[model samples]
Target chain A: MSLKNILSEKKDELLASWFDRILDTYPVETAKFLKNQKDRFANPVGQAIHKGIGDIFQELLQNGDIEKVSGFLDSIIRVRAVQEFSASQAVAFIFFLKSVIRDGLADISLTPELYDELATLESQIDSLALIAFDIFMQCREKLYDIKANEMKNMTYRLLQRANMVTEIKDAEKETNFIAIHKKEVNS
Target chain B: MAKLPKPEELLQINYNPPPTEDWMDRPVELKQGNFCWGAKGKNLAAVEFPNARDWTPVEADWKLPKDWEGTVLEAMADRLSKYRSFKVFMDICVRCGACADKCHFFIGGGDPKNMPVLRAELMRSVYRKYFTTAGKYLGKLAGARELDLNVLKEWWYYFYQCTECRRCSVFCPYGIDTAEITLMAREFTNLLGLNTDWISGPVANCYMKGNHLGLEPHAIMNSIEGMIDDIETITGIRINPSFNRKGAEILFVTPSGDLFADPGTFTAMGYMMLFHELGIDYTWSTYASEGGNFGFFTSNEMAKRLNAKIYAEAKRLGVKYIIGGECGHMWRVLNQYMDTWNGPADFMEVPKSPITGTVFDNAASTKMIHVTEFTADLIKNNKIKLDPSRNDDLVITYHDSCNTARGMGLLEEPRYIINSVCNKFHEMPDNTIRERTFCCGSGTGLNASENMEIRMRGGYPRANAVKFVRDKHGVNMLANICAIDRATLSASMDYWVPGVRVTGVHELVANALIMTGEKERETNLRGEPLPGKGGNE
Candidate 1:
């Protein structure tokens, strides 16, 4: 049987392990809310992350389509990049899949051909981490954007009060300069 | 108490050590920046609030007048005598921890003082020290301490930390309303001219000019004209809205934040479109432009004094009734405090929706109705035409503004309006919404950026709930009635639940509204394209 078939068959067990691992990263108190909440409206982010994991596994096993793999990775990474994790910690979950599969399949002896297929599966995840790094960077960039926007709004309002940014074009200039300076500041 | 820290050390974060000493033990040291800049003596004196002066909160000494402690104690005693509610709240806590976990601050930051029980204890400890016989004589054992600088600093930090959303009251078995306690604490702080620039600046501006932004008459017109131009761009209709027009049937008063900001301005646009469609005889008042009273955050007398202008403006405009725009605390002041403070309102008739003729008997005493209540009635009567499909791009959830939901029991009206106008609607976790709704965390004038860290921690519970819905339902829009919510939740949503758009309920209404004799549209009100018609698909 193909290695894809072997992994696809045990997808449920692998996913449960991955989900449990991710939940363990949060503080115990926060984990309770994220775990027990079943209603989508009540725990949307938790539920989204939970559902995205299974979709991610199926897409990887069923087909290694770059678009499909990136789509699933985007859903998971966008949230983690935003959460309290550092950059390395946020991307750590992506690599966990390799261990889950390796640990789950240990009993079966792999011939050279199957071992080669498993190597292919490992490389797929390696490719996924690069996409995830880009997505994570994008998320952090958006966060800095929000902080920048807040500072600009505060300054703009103050400048309005001071009669410095009163002219229409200058108001536009202040907004533009702040936006450009924000990118420079972030970079 | 520890020695005062330098000003630069103020931002260094530390959670106070767990309570090692008895409940009566003196509180921990306070860092600077927890308290706001003192109310400008000039601004306080202008508004006639006692002891208003220019003193920084960071300074070691306040330069209090002789007998200042006596003045504070006497003021508390006097307030206790007058308000049975105040006295009862001060006297009756069994130290049940029911309200501790309920505070957003406690949950987010893990600070014990942020717990509502502990936050309220700052006052209760002082009350025991001065008022009770046991506390007066056997102070420390009686869980009391003399009012000292440390206790005062603690009060300023925790009281301002509270958004006064009254979520704690919902959980308390004694029905101890923490908002009352928070307001009272701030009222006492006013005795020393202690206030923040974010607050006193607005109070001074509102006292002289009719709005908090210190907006002048021409400036108000200029801002509204800009809205009119946007309305013209979207609908090809340049309908002129009137200001200060005497004999207009209703006087419309909304928070000036709506005139100045993005999401609030969008909601203001919603009001204009709806009112213009009905041809309602309403006049906007630059003189009474503000609806949210910051003075309510200060003291009862100041709240009353600021609120007095709403009725005064209604009388001046010769309007039969008032129609308030989408605002949060404005209605709290209107429903609970306004009638008591400035009414017979005898000159103005009870408000009845002109379009649907639904006499709002609930507001007969106050003579003003919330805009959501007004809009809900119109939707129920089919007086307004709606195209819910225009909101197809949005999978929306309604955030119950704490004052509107708990203070006024205005839960159903906003939800009913949202349901009628939007095809996609979702409720957040039951515990996190409606009467149990969490605060936007920046209410009561703590919305400044310098305080963003505390604001985010305080906002976590609300954002956590939003993330739940955003993930589960692909929810993008969070609609609320409060102007402060519109501004502050924008920050909160961006921080914790990015990609979720915060909007006013009226903005959703305007987006779904299909006007008579209007051209076919490719976009909703913010000029975002109609779903499936343009880019969103």
Candidate 2:
């Protein structure tokens, strides 16, 4: 069986499984949104499915013609940055996706021979995604550490400057107070 | 100033009795010729790279006697283990080299090796060879070298050369601080009783006595009395800086050396003047006479013992607040280590400067403060009189000492004081300034005559920045808040930028102080009045 035919047969199972995994950790609103979107594309679902599946391949792998999917992935990563999710958290989120894919594969019915082939393909995909996730996390952590340390040092310098100004004021006051008192005593 | 004896002469002084058995088994090499010098002519500058060759190997029989072995050996073993333990941390680094350009020392000195990652690589390479399983098995394939006696000696020499300034951490992607490694190495070396007399003698003195300078109780009192008399002469303030006065509202703890030394003594006078102006109930503690922790140069135990006096004295005085004086590592040790290591004092209240009503929020987890912060707040609240004209001729530039600026994030307070008091103030280049500050080249007690080359090399980046300002803005005076910075930069200024002087930020403040009876404050050491008309000369 060709890869295209195989993916077509398991398309619904894949989508349903991914939706469930994402829904498990995410809020009900996000779950509902995905479900509603799925329902709207069910009529022309095969082509839509092909496109969505193609997108994931394009986004995850470097060479697939899945521009839309890659764009979506980029948006998600960028949004995660806005949320201030650390590189560690992002890597964990990717792992969550892999588990979802595994659970979805479990629900699909197929011949034993075909099922074995599919499982192998799934594992290969999982390995690729994990490697990519790890690399991204490492880079992110490095950048964040530098930024944080710089901020810390800058804050320290500011505090020291503030402390110096305080000392100057106190010194001036003492010098003036004594001078005034001395004058009054002399007069 | 007369030059001190050569390294050879100084080493033979029998300053402290040598340890009986020396664990060091490495050969000593002294290189002739000007190797690390930076400047030319009278300003002949170079950094002495203490390599494996400078250290002399000691016979096992010559090691500290068995009775002395417990403390010395255990301390050495502990430090060595720490050096070994940090191998995992050192090896785990992916060598992204993100920290390369981030170091002010690297940027200022233009020395690639000063880059934090590169500096760590020197130690990491040694660690990989000895400690890691991959290195043990694969050898050259795993990029590990053999850790020989020479390697150990090299580690002791080169590691001490680092100031333990955390400037490189600012650019490190993993927040890997070479400062921590430097401290660990120093601890290990000191345990073997292989310390330069300059730092070790002070550490031992601060440990056994109350102060690093070996100032007796009377000497400390007399110094304060002298400051009081100077205050009376300048401003007619007969304020007594009471020592060991129980139940004062504040226990003003300063680096004891400051009570005896120049510039620092002037800063001490500034503290007295401030305390008098605010009319606060504060006393100097004879017990905790020193805020400067030389233990920071060697072991944590020594650091803890030196730091213990402050709280103990604070408790004795029953003061609400303990204010620290101008010192670099003193603040770093206090802000970063003292609170957790020495624990808290329930007897003392959380510090609130009475003059400013500024309540410290335990931000750094310590109830103490840098004196500049206390006084800056008073000025902000309009509690003091300052004449900007007094500092008219001092085209001042501020040097952010690594400890105050990097360790504690205290950049603003000192600058605020400088801007308020000095009529003309210029800033050094932004990259080498503030949080990214370069060391004064002699931090971490590497200020000995032997280490002069390293100090000058480290100070090159800072000196260049000062030079840039002097060339462009005509900045002739460098104002800093750290005592070590004052000493280091004063030496650098003398050599690199002739006629440019260094003063504490407080000294500048004292100069601009507005005494009511006087027509104008004497802002400059030259006795020049504030520039322009109506300025009393």
Candidate 3:
């Protein structure tokens, strides 16, 4: 079957699996908040998901008809990462959506056999969510470490500079012409 | 021999108190005028001087160089740069006037010019007009007044009035220290060779000779020997305080004035006794013996050079750490400048005081541990046996020296030591204690006879506080750390309030300690036994 037909038949199952994989990482309250918010997902979240899923498909298959949907899902995770939402929080949010998607799929009167097929599709989404969460955490840690080291290095330098000036001052009672000259320039 | 008139009679010059009741009611601008001239319409020419012949302007002028005119502006600029911190502080002050009522001089003299902010403004206004861009262009618009001969004369008068005690900075929200301004002004005046002979002569002598009081190495040795003799008489401990001893664990640096003067030299002996009792290996370095930084009054380079000797001596002796003696500006310079300019001392260890076991962090930056702090910690930790009962009848009150209190935030250590050593410890009013403390009114080498009226006015508030304690609580003694405060307060107490004695905090601590061959130490003004006297067992 064509990729478009496959995705259309298994879209609900794919979303549900992705959601379940993300939910396992956060606390129960955050998982619940994400689930509730997903029920009424607004323009920003919808647009991000659409763009991300499209990009993912473009990279995965050059001529795949299912590229738009894959890019949309990819965009959702990438946008959430930049917002400083913790990896755990993002996972919990995806889990809530998975539970909602499961219920929605069940309400559609699909057969048990069809549901089994959908479960296979959901596993692919789960793998995608896990990979995105790992990348987000690694980037955040690197950024924080850089900032901390910069501050420490700056303080150490200032202390050294101050010490040099003090030594020159202590050596004699006469005015240090060098310090005086420097002072004139700075003023 | 006729006994000298009571300390009170010695300070009794014809001082007309400024109008106090009308002070708060008058406009701020009018108060500025009152500051410039002590009383309304009191001309500088009309002001009487009882001891004029020695300190007259003519005598001062005669001492100046032929090219003194060229050096005046150079000196002022040099001073402005030397105490660049002061210039930064002046520009930064928001004029909240929180430090207005805080100055003891302003409160006592009833002169608004004596107000820490106004006194600082006298130089700051001139600084703005001459140095800054906005002030140069906008002039009056920027509140920058031009520097003229009259302005120079006013600078000489009002700047001298300030003791550079830094009491105002404590209450200042932005830490706008006025002592920096006073030092800068003095530096400017000194550059023109227009210095009070009392201070400049000594400063020049210290520059040429190694000591402020012109004490030669032999004189210093003899002075220390004499102190050892006095200590032997008091406590029966015959200690030969080793000077310039190599490889000592610690190097003790003190003001040279202390080695020759009364009560101060006595206090020095007390430090020696404590060091001996503690069994700490410490030596006094004659080269760095003078801890008082007079260069702080004149030039930054001079200040640096003056301070350099101590570190140089410390390096030479290979001492583990250097300990400053009980002096004000010495601590300030040490606390603020020493570490920054002369450090990364790989050889000398950061001072881990043996008595307190408190490892001093930032020894180069706000890292100073005053002698009183060490003593207090030792007492608290039970390392030293102190008998408080020996100080009976000593109604002791502590006057926080501006340099120590405002510049260093050393409010509690001295008090903690005093309370631990003496039983009858009373605090002055809330306005005159701790961070809000007043100057002894004769700091920054202003203890000269020429600046008597200014000194008296500056010392007024502090004296009033002392008087308040005397009248209310029968307090008869003032304990302080700064040596200048001791001298200024001694003169002020003698003149303004009788029967009040001032001593270094360490003197009392030394008295309280259980020294060898002395079961009980003498009581101070209060009637309590000194610490370690008649205590348990």
Candidate 4:
């Protein structure tokens, strides 16, 4: 059988195993709470991971739109980016799926064509992990940008008070200095 | 050489925490992104706080007082004797774990110490060792420990981590106020000159300059003048607001944050427009310019001292009654502690709406009414006209500021005004709002940049609820009454749910209010185009 067929047949089992491995990153007590509290709104971090990985798995099996895959990856990685995880640790869950898929299909016999298909599937996961790394960096950049923006915002009125910030009127923008200089030169 | 393990065996990951019989055995690490910088000596000296010296929390030596232990214990004894409620909260917890998961910090950040019961136990264990009879003999068996430097560091770390939102108290069967314990712990820390610069700087500023932002009288006018200019641009009407004027009939007080910052600046513009439309007799006070008392985050005496200015300014201005602007902890202090702290405002009469003639008997004792309470009365009495279509672009949701919802029970008034002003309003899941509402995670002077990680962690649950509505209901605007909510929720929403923006309820009100002789409006308060007036259109 092909690797896609094998993955499709054992989809539910692989997804559960992958999710448990992803959750194992959090503290044990927190993992228990995240697992037991089933409400999506009440347990958002858990819900995001649970739903995110499933959507990603479906996309992988179908070789579907990369944008859809990135979107799902963004939702999960964004949570971990702001969390206590390093860059590699945040993207480590994608690698967990390889072990899950291999273990789920270990009992079956393999042909050369099936082995080649498995290599391709593993490469796709690696590609997904690369995309996850990009998303993690974007989230981190956004966080630092937010912190810098907040510092500026906190002192915004003080900046105004010290005559440091000026509000440029829209009418003044129409008469650009460069345009005026060009007109003067022509004259 | 050892034989190589199988791939599955190599892949196995352990999730369990290291085995420790007691949490007390885990030493505090004072991790980065978790704690704020220590209070500056200049700031403490400005307010004349005790043991005013330069210190760093990361340093091994805190430069504490020689008799710091005696200072803390003596202060504790004094507070225990002075306030029966403090003593009751100290001895009353049953350790039932009811409030363990209720704390936003605990729910969002997985550290077990973030749990409300364990956070309180940090203080309770020390109390048991000193005050309880069983602790002296049993020691570790009695769940008590010595209050050494390590314990003090733990107290500082955990107490400041709490935002004093009081979400845990709602779930506690005994109604144990965990926020109060944090407050007491902070008070002790202050005795050793241990205060976060975020809180102490503002406390000093409020004491000297009459606001946390330290705006001089002229600076306050300059900021308001800027808001007035924006109002003119949006509505083609010039609003003249007076500062520290006497006999104005009403005195307005609001958090200084509204006067500055995006989103918050828009909220300030909304307030001025609403007031100018009503043609009510009101004046802003540069003396009591800040409605939020940051000193409330420090010590009780400092809180009272800072809070005294409101009533003092009201009496001096000779206003009939006071109208307070949107703020979180300000209302907590105003509703629960103001009357007890600096009250008997017998000089000021009960707040009666000038336009609607509605008497605010709820604020009979305080003589100060929340602006929403005032505006809701106006809307109910049909005192002002509103075009809800002006806000057609926004799918709005109200986040109940923790202080206003739990401390004052002023729930329906903001909702009433929102319904009258906006076309779309959606309530987040019931468990995440009202008295059980999660904190902004950055309230009570913890809204500093250095601790953004923990702030985002604490804000995760609230952001999660907002994200739910943003996905399901297309909610793009978060409306709140608190100025800090306007400032901090903007950051949190941007981080967690990018499409959602934050606003004050009155910003929506001003957007919808149709003023007399006003030119056709194309933009809302922030100068953004109204629903159908976009550049594309």
Candidate 5:
């Protein structure tokens, strides 16, 4: 059988292992709760991660574009971005799939072409990790932007109320207005 | 590059928490972005808090008072005797894990310590060690430990992390209110002068100047004067509002946030426009300027001290009753704690709506009615006309502020008002609304900028629900009655679900309110052009 066929057959088993590894990063108690809870509204993080993993796996199998894959990654990364994970730790879950794919497909016959195909799949995941890092940084930057804007917004109305803010006149508008007024008077 | 590990070896990363060591032995790490700045000595001294001094949580030495442990234990013992609820809560948790996943912090961040049962156990452990006979002898076996400095620091970090939203208490089989435990823990911390600057500064301001923003009498007028001008520009009807005027039938008190912030300012305008449309006899007081009490976050004594001004001002102004504006914890205090702390408000009478002759017998004892209840009554009586089409630009969703939903049972009044004023309204998932509502996550004065990361963590569940509605209903505006929700949820929405704006419920009312002798309003109270009004959209 072809390497793609063998890997596709083991997809469900591999995906479950990869998902379990991702949950393993959380505390044992929290991991158990995340596994047991089924409701999306009640367990949002777990639901996102589970749904994201399945979609991401399908995209990988279809050799989907990185842009399509990123949408899946965002669903998971957005939750992890605010969680207690450093940037490295946050993106590290993507790397677990590499080992899971290799370990799950161990029983297949070792053809040279299969080795090349496996390496290509591994490279795809490596590139995915890079995309995830970018997504993670975008989420982090958005958080910082929100924080700075909050400080400004909290005092904005108060400053306006106190008359602490003054409108800075546009110099170009001033010159145009002066020209228009002077012409009108001369005419 | 160095040689990479084999696949089997690579899977053995220590990123997973070790299973061997128990969570109890994991030393507390006071991470940056997880905690707020400590209360300044001057701010604490302004309120005359015991052991007033400068302190920071990150520092090795907290500069605690000599024999601080003895002080805390004595205070705990005293409180154990004083509040029967405290004693029962300390004793009654069965740890059925019912509340473990319910906490927003735990659900979002996955920090085991954020679990409500475990968070309570941080205090319950100390309570067990010092107070219970089994814990005193058995120690670790009985789930108790010594109240050392590490334990004290853990208490400081975890107690403040709680917003006291009481979502966990809903799931607890024993009816254990974990928020009261957090309140008790905070009260103990305040005894050691350990308080957050976000909370202590407001407490000091409220104590000295009668408002959280420290706006003096003239400044309050100045701010309201700005709103009055905006009201005139929008409606072409200048509202002549009274300040500290005697013989006004109702005294209006709201959180100073409404007078000082963007969306909250708009809500304040809504109140004025609504009152003017109905032509109610109401007055604002500079003496009791703030409705939300930050002192409630500090200690019971301080909360009582801050709450006393409202009744005193009512007597001074000779208003028959009080009408509180849109706020969250303020209503919680009014509904639960106000009458107990400073009661027998015999000077005031039950609020009766002059427009519809509806008597608020529910507020007969407190003599203070919520603005939503009053407005909902008016709408039910068909006394006011609201053009819901004016709010066509907004696909609105209601976020029940934790204090209002869980603290006070204020679920339907705001919804009734929202339905009366807006064309589009959608409720978030059933579990995430009403009594099971998640906090805006920055309540009880944890909304400081330094703790933005943790605030976002705590806010994740709430933002998740909003994201659900935004995806399902194209929800663009998050309407709430809480002032802090107006302030903090804006940042949270900006972070978690961009393009979603936050507003006070009354802001929507003001946008849809049609007043007699008013010009065509090209813009809403926010000065943003209404849908089909501004040409650009």
Candidate 6:
């Protein structure tokens, strides 16, 4: 039987195993909130991840479409980006799927022919991890951009009160703020 | 392999920050980008706050006048006597730590000082030092400290960080409101001209121009005209809304932010449409254009000074009652503080909805009703028809603005209005909403972008909850009543949940209202497509 057939039939077991591994990464008390709760409203991040990972597994085993894979991956990764997860911890779940699949397929021995097919699948999982790194970088960049925007506004308002910003209503408000500071120094 | 962390490590949240020594031992250091510039002397002088001169929060000496401590203590004693709630709150607080985790700042930033108990203790410590028997003798053991400049700076930093959302009071067994303590602390600070530009600037503008943004009569007209153009685009209805018209039965007041900005402006359009459709005899007041009282953040006196205009203008215009627009602390001041300070508004009668003839007995004392209550009354009586499908593009969730939910118990009215207009509505987690709601983190005039760090950190818990709904139900729009929420939650939502957009409850109302002789709509108020007409939510 093909790998897709095995994954499709034992979908329930794989989902259950994958869910537990993700829960194990969180604090014991917090994990319960992320695990035991079923309502999406009560445990939204947990629920999205529980269903999201399952969707990722099915796409990988069935079609292996990069566009569809990124969609599921992006949904789950976005939550982790804002959470307290370190870079390694955030994307480690993607790598954990390989073990979940292996443990589920433990009963069947991989002969030479089967070994080649499974090894190729393992390589694809590594590529998915690299794609996750890109998403993580993008999220962190957005976070810093927001922080920078806030910092800019805080000082800009202060400068406005100080009469340091020389921009007229229709003119550019900030000529790199540095130029205004220099003008203040010269004056 | 678990070596010592770098110096910067302490700045980061410690997942489980250890609770070892007394919390008093850990001093609060004011971080840059987490504080507001001191109130301008001219701004403070405009309203006669004592010693309204130039000062800097970051400076060590703070340029206090002689006998500054005496002034603060006397003000505190005066306030304590005048408002028993402040006195009782100062004396009580057994430090049960029930309110520790309840604070959004503590949960988000992991600062022990951000704990509502500690934030209050900053003031309570001074109370113990001067006002109590044990603290006078026991000192550090009793959590008492000298009311020095460091203590003053700590109060300024952390108290401003507090949005005055009052989330902590819900968890306190004694219902010792931290907001009561914050108001008193802020009042004492005003004696020294120790206030933020973010707050004092608006207070000055509102005091002089009759609006917070200093919008004159012509400017207010230009803004309303802009909204009318947008309404014409979407609904094809040209409606005339009068300003400061005498003999109008009701005077309408709203936060001026609604006229100049979006989400809020759309909600403003909803009010104009709803009123024009009913053809009520209500006129907008350019003179009392501001519903939000920023002076409420500084002191009770300044707040009263700003709030007097609303009733003053109402009385002058001979309006029977008042309808206030969507605002958070505006309601808190109106519901709890206004009548006590500025009333016996005996000239005005208890507000009765002209459309439904429903007597707003709840507001009988104040004669001012929230716009949500007004709209909900109209909808309940079938006075207006709403097409919920027009809002099909929105997968909406209601954020309970901290003051509206807790201060006035206006929990159901906004939701009732939202449900009547929008097809889909999801709620945030139980703990994050209703009276237990987290703050938008920028209330009490902390919405200035300068203090975004603490705002983001304080906003984290609320944004985390929003992120939950956005992920689960594909909630794209967060609806709230307060103008501060509409302005500040947009930033928090962008940072934490990038896709989720912030909007006002009435914006959805305007979108769903099918006006008489209005054309079929293909776009929303933002000029975005309507759901079936190929909108990309």
Candidate that scores best on DockQ: 5
Indicate the docking level reached by candidate 5: medium
Query: How accurate is chain B of model 6, given as a TM-score from 0 to 1?
Result: 0.95
Model 5 chain B worst lDDT window (10 residues): B11-20
- List, residue by residue over B1-537, the lDDT tens digit for candidate 6: 889988898446332323446656656666665788888889988887778888877777688878988898888878878888888898888989788767776655545577788889889999998888889999988878888767777887888878888999999999999988888888888888888888999999999999888878877887788789878888889989999988999999999988865568888998898898888999999999999999999988899999999999998999999999999999999999889888988999999988899999999889999999999999999999889998998899999999999999999999999999998899988988999888988899888766766777678778878888888899999999999899788888887788999898888988898889989988988889988897364
Candidate 4 local lDDT, A1-187, one digit each (tens): 6789888989999999998988788777677777777877667788889999999999999965799999999988988876777677788888989999899889988788989999998999999989988999998888899999998766655665555655555685564221111123234
* DockQ score of each predicted structure, in the order shown: 0.10, 0.01, 0.00, 0.38, 0.55, 0.11
TM-score per prediction, in order, is 0.78, 0.63, 0.62, 0.93, 0.95, 0.78
Stretches of candidate 4 off by over 4 Å are: A109-114, A167-187, B1-21, B534-537
For all candidates in order, state the fraction of native interface contacts they contain.
0.11, 0.00, 0.00, 0.43, 0.74, 0.11
TM-score of chain B of each: 0.95, 0.82, 0.81, 0.97, 0.97, 0.95
State the lDDT of candidate 2 residue by residue for B1-537, as single tens digits: 998889898545321112322212224232211022111211101111111112223332223223443443355445556556454456567878666545434432333345567666656665566557887788767766665445445565556657887877787677777788777666655555544556656665666667776666766776677667666766655777688999888888877756654556677777777667667898887768788887777667778877888888887777877888888889999898888878676676777878777787763346787888887887888888887776776788988989988888998999898888888999987877888777787887766543444455466667767877998898989988887776668766754566688788777777777654543333343234445634553
lDDT of 4 by residue, B1-537 (tens): 999989998656443345544689889889777888999999999999998988999999999989899999899889889878789998999889889878887777777799899999999888888888888678878888888999999999999999999999999999899899999999999999999999999999999999998888988898889889888888899989888889999999999988877787787888889999999999999989999988998999999999999999998889999999989999999988989989988898998998888999998999999999999999999999899999998999999999999988989999999999998999999999999888999998999888888888889989999998999999999999998888889899989989999999889999999998788999988788987897623
Q: What is the lDDT of residue B342 in candidate 6?
A: 88
Residue A52 error, candidate 4, Å: 1.8
Ranking by DockQ: 5, 4, 6, 1, 2, 3
**Which stretches of candidate 5 lie above 4 Å from their native place?**
A169-187, B1-14, B18-20
How are the candidates ranked when ordered by TM-score, highest leading? 5, 4, 1, 6, 2, 3
**What's the lDDT for candidate 2?**
0.61
DockQ of 6: 0.11
Ranking, lDDT, top scorer first? 5, 4, 6, 1, 3, 2
In model 5, the clashing pairs are: none
Q: How accurate is candidate 5 locally (lDDT)?
A: 0.89
Q: What tens-digit string does per-residue lDDT give for candidate 1 at B235-263?
A: 88777899999999999999989988778
* Full-model lDDT for every candidate: 0.82, 0.61, 0.61, 0.88, 0.89, 0.83
Q: Candidate 5 residues B146-203, lDDT tens each?
A: 8888888899998889998999999999999998999999999899899989999999
